[model samples]
Target: MRDVIEGFLTFQQEIYPNRLELFKKLAEAQSPKALFISCSDSRVVLEMLTQQGPGDLFVIRNAGNIVPPYGPEPGGVTATVEYAVAALHVTDIVVMGHSNCGAMKAIAAGQPLDNMPAVSHWLRYSDSAKAVNEAREYGSADEKLNALVHDNVYAQIANLKTHPTVALALDQGQLDLHGWVYDIEAGVIDALDGPSRTFVPLAENTKVSALSTKLG
Candidate 1:
């Protein structure tokens, strides 16, 4: 807590003054271009990874980077998605998963979560990912884990589409969806190529439209 307080104080003393003008502009309102959904892992810093400043990307984060399918009892994730789409009109939504995800490890190992009921319940969102792994053969545990990470991103993208606002935006061609897997060890990001249906390194030359298809 002390560390966080000091950090904020440092920001106020140093960073904020330098960026005061930008902050003033942002204070009025925001028009973020993307809705970035990612894992709640401490290591997955979306803004830092994307080099985006405040007001650039609207982000939603949860354990496992999960987006629960839309239903009558709308949760925070659903509400945020609706707002980003209907109100903010974000042009893109990026669902990012990372290597060595604790949530994926928990799902794969089936670790007893008797003491962590909430975590166990929240992870149920990855059921489709688990099923995908169970039905396929992987060369090794690492490969399987990597596959699970990718599959989870894809799964969440599908779940995102179930939202009415997302559905409408997609139909009108006003929005785009993306799935990405970031390798922590390698410090590289693989953007899922929807047409080729494979992960590729993010490069300036990479055509985003080629990777916009719904992930399997």
Candidate 2:
């Protein structure tokens, strides 16, 4: 906690001053390129991982990186997705999941979360991912967790399409959706291959980002 405070002080006194002019421009308006949805895990730092500064990405982080299917009731994730697509006109959306995610681990292990009722309810959003695990056989905990991480990213992407705004943008070819799994220890990202329908090296994940900026 002390280190976190000290880091903030360093950013305030040094980093913020260095980028004062940039911050002033950002204060006026933000033109972000993508909507990044990921787990609210400390190991995964958005800006640091993407090397994106300030307003490059509109982000939403939650326990499981889950996005509930658009329905009668709208939540923060739904609202953010609508705003990023409809208002900000972001062209790219990335749903990212990381290795050994606790949320997925709990689901995979069938860990009882009786005390954490909200978490229990929230993880229901991952029901589709749970289905993926049910159809497969895994001999180890790591295998189960890894499979959950990858499937969860894809499941979330499917959920994203249920949003009217996302559906419209995708239908009109105004948006590109991406799914990703980050390997924390290895520092590697596996991007979902649309054609192959498999995860592959994500060396070109940011290709759409630059083009989206121009289009936006």
Q: List the residue pairs that clash in candidate 1.
A: none
Candidate 1 lDDT over residue span 51-93, tens digit each? 9999999999888999998886445999999999999999889
Supply the global lDDT for candidate 1.
0.86
**RMSD, every candidate, angstroms:** 2.5, 3.5
**Cα lDDT tens digits for candidate 2, 1-216:** 999999999999999999999999999999998899999999999899999999999999999899999985445999999999999999889999999899999999999999999899999999999998878999998998899998888888888889999988877879888888899999999988765667878886544221112222
Residue 51, candidate 2: Cα error in Å is 0.4
Give the C-alpha miss distance for residue 186 in model 2, angstroms: 0.3
Against the true structure, whose TM-score is highest? 1
TM-score of each: 0.93, 0.92
* The 10-residue segment with the lowest total lDDT in model 2: 207-216
